[model samples]
Target: MTLLSVDNLSKSFGGLMAVNDVTFEVESGSIVGLIGPNGAGKTTVFNLITGNYQPNTGTVLFDGQNLVGLPTHTIVEKGIARTFQTIRLFQNMTVLENVLAGAHCRMRAGCIAAMLRTPAQRREEEEAMRQAMGELEFVGLGKEWQNKAKNLSYGNQRLLEIARALATKPKLIVLDEPAGGMNDQETQELITLIRAIQDRGITVLLIEHDMGLVMRVCSSLVVLEHGAKIASGTPAEIQSNPRVIEAYLGADSE
Candidate 1:
C-alpha cells in the first residue's frame, strides 16, 4: 500500500524554486531513499511533506489525507513525524523528558485536566511516560534516561531524536540525514536500527547523502536534481543508471 504519496509537489521561496512538481510514493514498511546533490532540494521536500512550507502546487497524502496547509503539529497528529537534518533535541532536558515532550501530541488532557490531575489524566500521563521509556530502550538509550540530552555522545544524541519521534507513535517516520556525522561503528548501528524500525512496520522515508548506507538500508531510491525527480528504482538500478551517474555521482565516479 502507498502509505505516503506526494503528487506533483512544488515549493517556491521568492525566486528560488526549491522543489518542483516532484512526485513519489512510499509503500508501507519500506525504507525509501530520497537522494541528490547538495542543492537538490531534498530537505525542501521534507519540509513540504511535514507542513513546514505551503506548496505552490500539488498534494501530499499521508494515509490518504491531504497534508498541505496543515500546521506542523496537526501534521504530526495525522501520524507523520520527522527529525530535522540537524539534531533538534531539548538540550537541557533529560533524555526521557525529551521523549515525553514528543508524546505531548498523543496526550488527551488539556490545560485544566493537567492542572487538576484528574484520575483519567494521571492514567494518560503515566501511559505516555511508559511509552517514552519504551522508545528510549528501543533505541538503546534506556540506561541514560536520566541524563541530559546534551550529555549524550553525538551518535546517541541522534538516536535520542529518533526515540523522541517514535514517542509520537507515527505510522510514517521521515529521517533527514540520519547518518550525517558518524564513525564506522556508529553508521553500522544506524543501519541496524533503521532495519529494526522497518521491522516494527513503520514506513520510513530517508533523505541521505551516504549512498553506501542508502544502498544497504533502502529497498528503493528516488533521485532528485534541481527540485525535480530524474530517476527512481531499486538500489542496483539506481547505482548503474547513466543519468544518476552523470548528474549525481559525476562521470568519473564509480
Candidate 2:
C-alpha cells in the first residue's frame, strides 16, 4: 500500500531547476531512501512533497488525497511530518516541551479551552504529555526528558527531533540527512533507531548521504542527480547501478 506518492513532481527557484520531474512512492510501512550527490535535488524533492515549496508541476498524494497546495502544518496534520537538514528545535525548551509542541496540531482543546483551564482541557493536556513521553522513551531520550534541548549532545538532539516528529503521530515521516555529521558509533545507533521507527509501522522517507545507513534501513532506494531521478530500486540494485556510482561515488570509485 502506498502512504505517500510523488508523481512527476517538479520545482524551480528562478532560473535554476531545483527538482525536475522527480517521482517516487513510499509504501505504507517501508523505509525509502532518497540519495544523491550534493547538487542532486534530494532535499528539493522532500520540500516539494512536504509543501515547503509548491511544485510548478505534478502531484503529491498522501493517503490518496492531493496535497499539492497545503501548508506545511496542514500537510503534517494530514499524517505526514518531517525534520529539517538542520536541527530545528526549541533550544531553551525542555525535551518534553519540544515533543509536546509537536502534539499541538493533534490536540482538540481550543484557545478558549486552554485559557479556561477546563477539566476536559486538563485531561487532553495529560494525554499529550503521556504521548510525548512515550515518544521520548522510544528514541532513548527518556532520561533527559526534563533537560533543556540545548543541553543534549548533537546526536541526542537528532534523536530528540525524531522523537518530536513521532509525537505528531504521522503516517509518514521524512528525515533529511539524519546521520550527516555523526561518528560511526552514532551512525550505528541512528540506524538502529530508524529501524525501530519503521518497526513501529510508520512509513519513513529520508534523504541521506550516509549510504551505509541508507542500505541498512531502507527497503527501497531512490537516487537523484541534478534535480532529477536517476535510479530507483532495492539496495543491491542501487549499489551495482553504474550510473549511481559514476554520478554519486564518482567514476573512479568503481
Candidate 3:
C-alpha cells in the first residue's frame, strides 16, 4: 500500500545540509503529518519529494518508479501533486479558471483540436469545466466559482489552492502548511476539509507547525529536527515522545 517512498534522502546548498538522510513511506489512503518548528527542514523535505529539488543523495520512488531525475510536471503527471506554504493562484483568473488550469495537464486536446472545435475537444472542455466546479464545491468555494482569485477572503484563497491541487487528480497530495495564518474558526473549517479529502481515498502528506491541528487530522506523524527524523508515531505517542518534545517544543513547557 505504499504509494511513495523516500530512501535516505538528503539535500544541500553549498555546504549547508537542509535535509539529511531522511527516510519515510506514505501509505496509500493515509493522512501523514510532517511536523517541526520553523527551519526544521519540513518544507525542504516536501520540495525533495515533489521534485522541486533533487536530492544530493537518495531516491524518491513513486509507484516503484525512480522520480529523482524527473521534472516537476512529470512527477505531477505520475499522480503526485502539492500546494505551497504560501497560497499560489492565478490572481487574475476566476476561481473556476484557476481550477481548470490544473486540469490542463490531463487534457488530451491539442492546440489544433481546441482551435478546430473537434467533438472530442469539446467533450474534454465540458468535462474539465464540470470537474472544476466539483473541485470548487469540494473545497467549499462553489459560490465563488466565478469570482477572481484575489477577490476571495484569505481563508477561501487557501481553499481555492486545495481545490486547484485536487484538480490534478493526484493519488498523493502534499500540502505545506495548509493552515498557516488562519484564525481559529478558519483552522477548524480547514481541519474538516482535510478530513473530507482523506475520506475520498487520496493519501495526504502534510507539513505543519500546528501540533493541535496535526494531531487532529493526521493518522500518522513524523517529527524532524536539523533535517533528520527525530521521532514518528501516532499522535498520542508523538505528543509524549521525549525526543520530539525536547527538540521541537520545550521539554519544560508542555
TM-score of the candidate numbered 2?
Answer: 0.97
Tell how far residue 188 is off in model 3, in angstroms: 1.1
Query: How does candidate 1 score on lDDT?
Result: 0.93
Least well predicted 10-residue stretch by lDDT in candidate 2: 245-254
lDDT digits (tens) for residues 85-149 of candidate 1 = 98998899999999999998999889999999999899999999999999999999999999999
The candidate scoring highest on lDDT is 1
List all candidate RMSDs to the true structure.
Answer: 1.1, 1.2, 1.1
Per-residue lDDT over 91-113 for candidate 3, one digit per residue giving the tens place of the 0 to 100 score: 99999999999988899889999
lDDT of 2 by residue, 51-164 (tens): 888899999998999999899999989988888899999999999999999988899989999999999999999999999999999989999998999999988898899998
lDDT order of candidates, best first?
A: 1, 2, 3
- The parts of candidate 1 lying over 4 Å away from their true place are 251-254
User: What TM-score quantifies how close candidate 1 is to the native fold?
Assistant: 0.97
What candidate 2 gets wrong by more than 4 Å, as runs, is 251-254
